[model samples]
Target chain A: MSFEISVSRRLGQGVIALDMAGGDGITALFGPSGAGKTSILNMVAGLLRPDRGRVAVAGRTLFDGDAGIDLAPERRGAGYVFQDGRLFPHRRVRANLLYGARLATPEARATGLDIALDEVVAFLGIGHLLDRWPRTLSGGEAQRVAIGRALLACPRFLLMDEPLASLDAARRDDIMAVIERVRDEFGLPTLYVSHDRAEVERLATRIVAMPQRDTA
Target chain B: MSSFLALTPDDWEIIRLSLKVSLVAVALTMPIAFGLAWVLARLRFPGKLLLDGLVHLPLVVPPVVTGWLLLLAFGANGPAGRWFADWLGIEFMFRWTGAALAAAVMALPLMVRAMRLSIEAVDPRLEGAARTLGATRWRSFLTITLPLSLPGVLAGAVLGFARSIGEFGATITFVSNIPGETRTLPIAIYSALQVPGGEEAVTRLAIISVLLSLGALIASEALSRRAGAGRGGHVL
Candidate 1:
């Protein structure tokens, strides 16, 4: 399995129990809004810890309650693009893209993506947007830069949490194309979260439905 | 311009001393205050409430009380003050440095409050986003939280500087008014007010003080607004 996650964590007063495994291409977490889809992604990314369970990606144990193996988010190398496109507003697009690349681990540099920063930039068609700040970019353009930034990290896997939710249909298609291209060329598994069946149908190779959990 | 204020060396020195003292106080307090504000904004320690209360203590306490506390902690006979004098040749008793210490203490609460408000306003999601992109906690803070909070930092510094310039009771109590040393513009005006037929001198100095404070406020406001325009704003 490229990704194996069986975890339970509390959200306020309720518990979110997720158990799933996947291999290859985009594994879409299909569900309605607030079904803890984003929570699963957060656990895989090591941004949230599970109360008792193991999360292993490509045989690298990211978190294991039994073995006491919990890596920091930075060490996990699982890139995550938030729904709202949390690009650093004060930084220019180029700087935001270079943030992870500048801090790339020795292991990351050994990957095929070592010199692919320029390639990613070209692929995302963000060269024209490089000098501008995030506040100047449209939602579609910002989403592209956000994806480009995560790719520059050479992450073990990519977790995209409804990256197209905030865009119009046309703009959503624009970002969807870039995401498809990244999935094809980046050589990493992508767990795409979404509530829309059409979006998942268009993007996912294999689908795992998120059981609607009560957040109350 | 009055003949008493025709660029007289004494008048100019007073203005220069006030600027120097206030600037030095701001410089000394900025980094420390930023650290304190960030901690207060981000962390939740056991004594966090107590620390917050202590920081704002100077704001509520009388200026003279703060001056007395400074004198107790930083006076020549005090352990910290004596160690400084013996080891580093630094003295705070009745010196210009002492005036700066007083001003910094008085201005710290304002700086910390402004910065904390700005820091709190920053989206924590940005820092979390940064962390997932291979940035450590410190790295995320420097890249995301710190830069996004710049407007607050600048706002705090400007507020601190303005407060330092206007500080009088704490400064005079701690450092005492001395010619060409601890005697800043406020002290000069006060001295002029006490003397018979020194009305013109007092009036000229008071005008300069008002202008300086107003100018600083205006400049800082503009800069803060520009800095804040970046965050929490809708993109086209």
Candidate 2:
């Protein structure tokens, strides 16, 4: 199992709960809007604390509420590609791509696990955007840069939250191909959140259906 | 134009002293003001409202009252003043240092307000993204929050510098006007008004003061507009 998550939390008069054991490839959380799909991603990334649960990725326990083991987000090593491509507006594309890799652990570097800046940039086809700022890029280009940034971190697993939700149909195909490449080439276990069933069916090796809870 | 060009040596000395005092005052208070602004902008504790009110007190109260409070707290014989005198051997009784301190106190509220507004405008989500990218909280703040709020910080510093240049009441009350040591532009202008045949000097000093203040205000306004633009052109 690449991802073993069993968590539940109360949010604004509603409860969100999930129990999933994912495979080594891509695991998609298939659900409609407001089904706490994004919340599950947040919990796995250590951004949101689960009320009572355990989250173990790649045999490393990131959060275990019963055991009182909750790591910080930076220490968890989750390559989170946000839905909105939250790139640093102050930095250029080159800097954004190298940000996480620059802070990678010395052990990770010595073990040859860190991704090179040039390789990720070339892989994402963002070489021409090296000197450009985040605000100057198109939505698709920005999302690619965001993906490159996460990949360069060389995270143990990737957590993508609706990475193509904002792109047009053409742009979505472009990102979908990138995701497929990441899955096949990099071989990194991924937990992808998406409301679109067709997109999940095309990419996810195993799909976990998220049930919507009615709020009183 | 000839008369304006022919400023006396004393006039130049007053201008130099004013610049020195204001610059030192701003340099000393900027980091302190930024820290206070960050606290005011990001944190919420039991006494946050009281702390905010206390920081803004100097802005609302009379300058003389602020000066008097400073004298009571930091005077030569006062507890803090005595502690510093004994240990640090620093005195603010009647020195230019006292003038600078008074000016810093008077200018702090404006600096804090400007910095707080900009710091508040920074998106916390960006910091979260940075943290998730393996950057620690402090690192994220330094790289993301600090850089994003640069314009506001510059605006605050310029505004503080302008306020310090015009500082008069608190400086005079805390540290008496000494010719080259403590007499700033405003104090010098006041002195020139009381002397016979000193109208030329007074007018020249007053005009200089107005020009300096107006230039600073314009620069601050421009910087604040840039700050808004930095936030993806969102007006706060």
Candidate 3:
């Protein structure tokens, strides 16, 4: 088991809960629009605090409500690829891609798990866009750079939230190929969140459907 | 008018002192203003409203009242003044330093407001993105937030500098008009007005003051435009 999540949170007037333990591959949290799929990913990334639960990824306890142990987002080392790419507008593409490497701790750097910049750049096919600013990139190019950035962070696990929701069909195919290579080559455990059943079927090794909530 | 325009050595000294005091005051106030603005823009806590009000109080209250408050806290025998004197051997009582301090207080509100608006314009989500990429909060702020808000910071500095140069009531009240020390441009103009046959000198000094303020205003405008352009033409 590479991921364990049993968490409940109060969102507005309702409660959202999830309980799952999955293998060391891409486990997709498949659900409808308001079923709290993104919320689960947020909890795993340490962005949203769970009201009560435990989140362990790859033998590391990221959050334990009973033990009063909740790590900060930076300490969690979860590479989160947001829906909008969220690239730094002020940084050039090269700087954006290298941001994670620049921020890695000395101990993490010494561990030899650090992904090479050239290899990732070549793998993602983003070498041509390196000098350009984020504002100048197309949706597909920006998403590719965003993925490269997350990989360079040396994350313990991956949390992706609807990363292809905005791209057109052609761009989606390109990014889908990239995600496939990242999963096969990097071998990092991933918690993928999406509403598109086709995307989940194609990429996910196992599917965990979100529990239905009372909309009334 | 021509004779009046011919600046005397005393007038030159006053202009030089004014420039020095305002520059030092802005340089000192900028980092403090940016810190406060960030707190107000990004943090949510109890008494935030009270803190915001306190920072803007100088802009609303009479400058004389601000000077009086400064005197009570930073006087020679006051706590901050006494500590500085004991440890750093620096004094603020009736010195040019006191004048600069008064100007800084008056300029704080403008500087903080400008910086706060710019900081608020940056999406908090970007910082979150940086954090998930192994960046500590401080690193994200320095790398993402600071660079994005550079224009506003520069504009705030210029605005504060303009305000500092025009400072009069607080300066006159805190540090008496000491010649060659605290007698900045505005104070010199006031002093010249009291003497007979000093109208020409006053006119010249007033014109110079106006020109300096106009220059600062134009520079801030240019910086704001650049800020908008850099942010993909978003009207900041």
Candidate 4:
């Protein structure tokens, strides 16, 4: 499915104007720390409402300012993985994985929990960590689990916000491989945010740059 | 020594009453504190500053003044009190329920403050992550926000309970110190101090109060440390 996003927002210290549109492939949002890359992903995920813009994924209007249509993040069907894993600390890994599945509508449950859970776990190679707590996982392992948790939600598109920024170079490579595999295997559109040009070059099929805002 | 041994019944009753009052206070204020903390930490509304100030007003107001306000709002013949008594047969004035209400009011600010800090400490990005995972706002809070903020919520409860256990001005002004009714440990201690040769009884009660407060503080610190360790050594 295709994903189209054009958003303009006034963030911390400047205005962020982002205009981009792409189809089923990894679209890299590349820029410096404050270049509004994350903001654009957030807009697409419906986490941040743009002052003026339209976000459409696969011809479905997720947000249209003039049309007064703004779907909440949950209804947008976009999988988002944050830089930090942000896993539920109190829940076991298995419980955290099922959290999203539990929120699925009744119609979505016909697919069966065991099938979805096993598929995500096998795909992410986190089968052994299911009973473990989030605190027990390394940086790379946690990110993998985070990705698995997001995918289990059955999203139409994936929005990743600097998911590899916190890992070491070796760990970054490891998680990067998983990300690419997911993108290719699922055949779903992916939007990745990153400051590393090498990562963008390696993973992204399309590049969207967010310009830095002027301080004065 | 004989008098102290003879008052065992009174001592047990006071201790039991204190625990009951603190537990009720903590229970009554927990959900409210959670709701307020979420609003303060996550959403930015027009009157947010005013609401924040109001939530914290009890902390700055003298306990006696707070007790007076509660009496005016919930005493017999008062608007809410009269309606409650007429409709639900609930009377709070000069009763154990009144003591719990006073303690809850006194303890609310500390509860909200601790919870607010912890909720604010949580990464908003995580909530965003939960949202993208098909969890609605309320669901996201229940699954992600609440669990992640558990340490802080526990700390808030312990702090509130400790504060309630020691609450004096408000409890006395609102409920009065009636044995087997509204008299908590602190109230009992205060009463013991009023009589001749009551020094020894006061000393024993004082020691118990100190131990309980210290225990709560230690528990809260341990919980916070565990939460921090769970987050990969990052203190949230």
Candidate 5:
């Protein structure tokens, strides 16, 4: 899917403006912490509303300030994975993976659970962890499960917020491989947040750099 | 000893009435406590400070004063009580229902505080994750927020139950100690202490009170531990 997001939001005294467009591939938002990388992803996920701008995903207007159109997060069709895997602690791995698929509209669910499950399981190699509790999984394993859970949602775009940040060096390398495989196989447009330049070089098809805000 | 051992018909009535009032109070207050706790922990809106203060008022105010206020608002000739009598043929003054109302008021703060802390501890990022996965606000709350806060909810319920079981001043002031209708375990104990021959009976009731409170605390601890274990052996 192709989309463009041009938005401006106030941060403290200054405004953080974002203008970007890309087709189907991983677009890395590279910046140090507090450089508004996560803010851009939040806007894309409909978690934060832009002060003035438009967001369109695959020709669908998600937000348009003049038209007064703002779709809620759920309606945006973007799967989001947080820095910490936000797996439901009470639910088992299978339940967490199936949550989004179950809640999807009938037409969306028509893709079939088995197909989605098989694809995500193979893509992220989380088949073994299906029955285990989220807490039992290692950091890398948990991140794979989180990614698989998002894939089951069958999102138009995947928004990853520093998904590899919590893992150790070796674990980050392993999980990044799984992420790259999923992105290529699914052919889904992804907005990846990261501070690591090597990660961006290895995974991103395009890069958007954000710098720290200056204090006067 | 014989008197304490004998479970008289009136004693049975007091036992049943106490359970009835406490159960009703706990049931009625759970949803309200959950809502108030969520708002306090998650939302930033105008009047939030006032709402926070109001929810905590029962904790700080004397229970007797709270009962007095309820009596003024729901007494026979009072606005709400009069309307209830005229329109619904219901009365709260000196009734078991009034005892339940007082218990609910007294337990509200404990419930809200436990739930608020739990809700606050939940990762907002998780909710954001659910939102991206096509969950509406209410659905996310039902499936995600509510489940994650289960330990807190259980803790709140247990605390409320303990508070309700031991409630005395407000309950006595609002509903009085009608032996078969409004008298609860605590009231029974208090009454027994006032009589010359009721010393043993008071001891029995006191023992029962202690046992029940201890049981509730143990149950809460066990529940929290189980929940934490389910989340991968990390205690919340």
Candidate 6:
């Protein structure tokens, strides 16, 4: 499956134009902090529309600036894992995981949601934390839940933006193992973003380095 | 703390009538107050300051002045009062409903203020997260925003109820003290003090009023606490 995106944005740092092309496995967008990495992922997720350009996945167009076609985030079929896990404080772990999954159509879950949920529960080892409040969770536990939540949405692809930045070294390694397992378990193509060289070396099938910020 | 059995038929009538008027007043204003609070908390529009000032005028102005304004706008001789009475066959002139209207007006500001504070406290990011998770904007508001802001709603409602129960100057000016019709507890107490040998009756009614107002305050605290904890969210 081919995934390609070419986007140009005018941020305060100056104009940034990013382009990437990849097939299968984890394509890590390696960059320094504030190098427009998260912005690129946000554009693909339809969270932020690029000033100009197009994005496509597996021959389906998700956004095309020339045609003025931009899908809403919910219809983009892309799941996002933020740097800080955005768990709903009002909901339990199970409820947060199931929130978007329940809205998924039958075709979205080709493997069956129950089966997918069970697999995610097994894959992430979050089965025991289902009924607990989000506040009770450790940073590592919350991030894992966030991943399982994204996976349950049955997204066409996953976009992870510094998912390990907030964790301790031990927790970071722990989540890396979970991420590796997720990629291997479903063969799901992931576009991972991080500034850490070690993480890129450990997980990137292809590394796309971002250009430095233009001072103008 | 006189026993309910010790209360004479007249004393019971005043207490029951007071409860009925205040309850109806709260019911009339709850949805409207919440709507205004939501608007103030979430959106901005032209003349917002003017609307806010008008809503709070009753709080700052003398209660008698507020009563006069209500009468001028909703009295039988007034345009709105005339339209409502002629079209809907509803008259507020010397009626318990007029007293209720005054009570609602006096209590509305407190309710809106309390609810607005709570709404402002709720984290906007939570709603944003919900939207990204397939919930429509309206859905996110109902499922996420509303529940998170409920502690304010509970506090507002209870404060409104208490304010309604204590409404005096406005009710007397708008509806006057007509026994078994427009006379509420405050009006009854005021009337009792004017007549000889009505001291015993006043004491009982005053006790009931104090008891009811304190009960409302205590219940609001308990209910708001439970709502905050039960929802498992941070209150503003």
| DockQ for each numbered candidate | 0.83, 0.82, 0.82, 0.71, 0.80, 0.45
CA shift at A111, candidate 5, in angstroms?
Answer: 10
Considering TM-score, which of the candidate structures 4 and 6 is the better prediction for this target?
4
The local distance difference test score of model 4 is 0.83
Ranking by DockQ: 1, 2, 3, 5, 4, 6
User: What order do you get sorting by lDDT, best first?
Assistant: 2, 3, 1, 6, 4, 5
How do all models score by TM-score?
0.92, 0.93, 0.92, 0.87, 0.92, 0.84
In candidate 4, which residue pairs get closer than 3 Å at backbone N, Cα or C atoms, i.e. clash? none
**Candidate 1, pairs of clashing residues:** none
Q: Per-residue lDDT for B1-236 in model 3, tens only?
A: 57758888988899899998999999999999999999999999999999999999999999899888888788987888898889988788878888899999999999998888888888999988988888888988988899988897898889889899999998888887998889998999999999999888889999999999989988877776777665542222
Q: After superposing candidate 5, which stretches have Cα over 4 Å from the reference?
A: A107-115, A214-216, B1-4, B225-236
Show where candidate 4 strays beyond 4 Å. Answer: A106-115, A211-216, B1-7, B228-236
Candidate topping TM-score: 2
Q: What TM-score does each model's chain B reach against the true chain B?
A: 0.93, 0.95, 0.94, 0.92, 0.90, 0.92
lDDT per residue for candidate 6 within A1-216, as digits (tens), equals 557989888888687778888778888999999888988888888777899999997677889999988887766667678888888888999998988787676666663223367777887889999999999999999999998888877677888999999999999999999888877876667899999999999997889998876667
Docking class of 3: high
Candidate 1 lDDT over residue span B193-220, tens digit each: 9999988889889988998888878766
DockQ of 3: 0.82
* RMSD in angstroms between candidate 1 and the native structure over all alpha carbons: 3.0
Residue A134 lDDT, candidate 1, scale 0-100: 92
lDDT of each: 0.86, 0.90, 0.88, 0.83, 0.83, 0.84
Could you tell me the C-alpha RMSD of candidate 2 in Å? Answer: 2.3
Which window of 10 residues has the lowest lDDT sum in candidate 3 chain B? B227-236
Off by over 4 Å in 2: A110-113, A213-216, B230-236
Query: What pairs collide in candidate 3?
Result: none
Clashing pairs in 5: none
Interface RMSD of each: 0.9, 0.7, 0.8, 1.4, 1.0, 1.7
Q: Weakest 10 consecutive residues, lDDT, candidate 5 chain B?
A: B227-236
Docking class of 5: high
lDDT of 5 by residue, A165-208 (tens): 99999999898888888777777788899999999999999888
